[model samples]
Target: MFYLGIDVAKAKLDCYLLTQLEPLKGKAKVVTNTTKGLADLLIWLTKNHIPHDQLHVTLEATGVYHELAATQLHDAGVCVSIANPAQIKHFGQGLAVRTKTAGVDSQVLARYCAMIKPAAWTPPPPEARILKGFLARREAILQDLLREQNRQEKAESTVTPELIHQSINDSITFLNAQLKKLQSQIDDHIDRHPGLKNDLD
Candidate 1:
């Protein structure tokens, strides 16, 4: 299996393609960190005569920067391994890598993956990701509502001015409405996306 190593960054992805496992060396390329860039990367692979099913892409997780590429490749039927950062680092250390450059790091990643054959990682499906976003917003609104409630309670218990209590009460009411609206939106979204509903069920 051909291994492709990617060193993910916020702005670009440094890649090293390992056509053969013997030397852990091949072509190096840089692509922007975006969907368009991923598309171009696929085109590059096809131009190299590499099929999606035969490609094994590996990269160390760098915050959320790696997620987009992983998801895109996985969806395109490419095997993707999100290597453990610590493990990748140790593997690179074993190689005695001197200066850390995009090219060097990507080369190390390619070598480690070619030898270790790390387990493939799967990102959440699109429907699941949507639900996650909704859930995150819901949690944030809940936290805000709780804070407002706490403030209201304190105001009622202390010598706080009446206007302060009224303001807190208004905030609590607004938050409640927002929570209800958000929940409705979430429900509607799930209904629109059967996969999400099925997952929840």
Candidate 2:
């Protein structure tokens, strides 16, 4: 059996492949948060002769960065496990591995998987996924609006340009509209999904 561990980030994935009687092998691969990246990963795995069913894959739950990949892998019939980063860090402390890099992190994950053999986590249902997407988009828009507001305030005493104020107002208005739409969609989605509605209640 092959143990695959991944250190996931927003822009790239550090992958480690561990097998018995061999030195640890790892590679840092760039992957976008999109279907193309998911397809590429599947292709790479196939080329390497890694059986999706036989491979035990583990990655840290570094927020939503790991969600898409985990969902894709699980849907493809691979055994996938997500570990809490804090737990993984504590485990690494036991091994006295202090330094942190993508490669080292990947190796640590591989070793952790080998030791703990965590059970796979099933992805949330489709409605929950949609709700999560809406929430994330709304949060992103709010963040952008906040950044623009900060910029506008910083330039208040320096420039006092009418155009800058207009731009800031326009951005805020746009973000508000987007947030409203997302909220409505999320509410409707949660209402329709009894599981999520129950969880919220």
Candidate 3:
């Protein structure tokens, strides 16, 4: 089995290809972390004559930066491993890897994965990801409401314009209405998933 290790960053991904018998295939390369870039990487692999089914990609989760790549790769029928950073780090130490760079990190991840052969990662369901996004939006709106209310309190009777005060109140009202709608959707989603509802209960 061939392992492809990727070190993900906000703007780019450093990739290294390896095989169990051979430590490295070629020099590591960097590609922009975008859909087009990922496509190009696939093309590069094909140009190099690497079979997709023989490849297993691995990377450390870096917040949401890794999500797009992982999802895209998985959707393309590629196996992906989202390794724990601590575990990867320990593996690096075990290999006596004293230097660190994006290329080096990718190499270490590939070597570690080749040695350990971690299980493939599955992306979350689309509905669950959407719900999570909505929840984050709701939280942001609540925070905005809190901040506006605090500002209103501080500016109370301090010669603030009536129009400005009214605008703030209107914003809060809109946010509250949105929050209610969001809560209803969330509840409906939870109800649809018996396992989630049970866990919540």
Candidate 4:
């Protein structure tokens, strides 16, 4: 089996290949984290004679950045595993790696997969994925609300412009409405799944 370790970032993906015979043998490639990049990666792997079935891809769970690649690869019939970053970090420590970079991280991930052969990761259900997206958006809105509220409080203390105060109040009101909408949707989503509801509770 050929192990393809991908170190994902917001803009690019760094990849390294590993095999049982030569666990640390392969060149690394950097590509954008997009559909075109994923296609290019597939082409590169194909040119190198690594068939889809022989390919075992692994990457750390890097927030939502890794999701697109993971989902795309899984859809394309490639074996994919989304490993925990902490697990990968500990594995790197085991290898006595002091320096860390995208290249080095990909190498470590490749080696870890080659040695351990982690279980394949199945994509989460559509409902779960949707709920996760909602939660992330809600958190962002909440943060925005907090910042606006702080600005409002500061405006109240200082001799700020009236327009600025009005704008802040308007933003706070809009964010509050958004939060309530998100909360209702989240509650409805959780109610649809007993397991999720129980876990959340």
Please write out the lDDT profile of model 2 over residues 22-124, one tens digit for every residue: 4545444445656788788777777878888887789999877898888988899888999999988998899889999977887888888877999988998
Backbone clashes, candidate 3? 0
Instruction: Identify the runs in model 2 with alpha carbons over 4 angstroms from their true place.
Output: 21-34, 96-99, 140-173
Q: Rate the local accuracy (lDDT) of all candidates.
A: 0.90, 0.80, 0.84, 0.90
Root-mean-square deviation (CA) per prediction: 3.9, 3.8, 2.4, 2.9
lDDT of 1 at 3: 85
Clashes of 2: 0
Error of 1 at 46 (Å): 0.7
Better of 1 and 4 by TM-score: 4
Count clashes in each candidate, considering only residues at least 3 apart in sequence or on different chains.
Answer: 0, 0, 0, 0
Model 3 is weakest, by summed lDDT over 10 consecutive residues, at 19-28
lDDT of 4 at 154: 97
Candidate 4 has what TM-score?
0.80
Residues 97-176, candidate 3, lDDT per residue (tens digit)? 89989999999888877788889999877766776777788899889889988878866858888898898888888888
Q: lDDT value for candidate 4?
A: 0.90
When 3 and 4 are scored with lDDT, the better candidate is 4
Q: What tens-digit string does per-residue lDDT give for candidate 1 at 67-184?
A: 8999999999999999888987888888888778999889888888789988988888777888988998999999999999988888889999888988999999999999999999
Expressed as tens digits, the lDDT of each residue in 67-181 for candidate 4 is 9999989988899988999999999999999899999999998888888889999998778888888888999999999999999999999999999999999999999999999
Residue 65 lDDT, candidate 4, scale 0-100: 94
The TM-score leader among the candidates is: 3
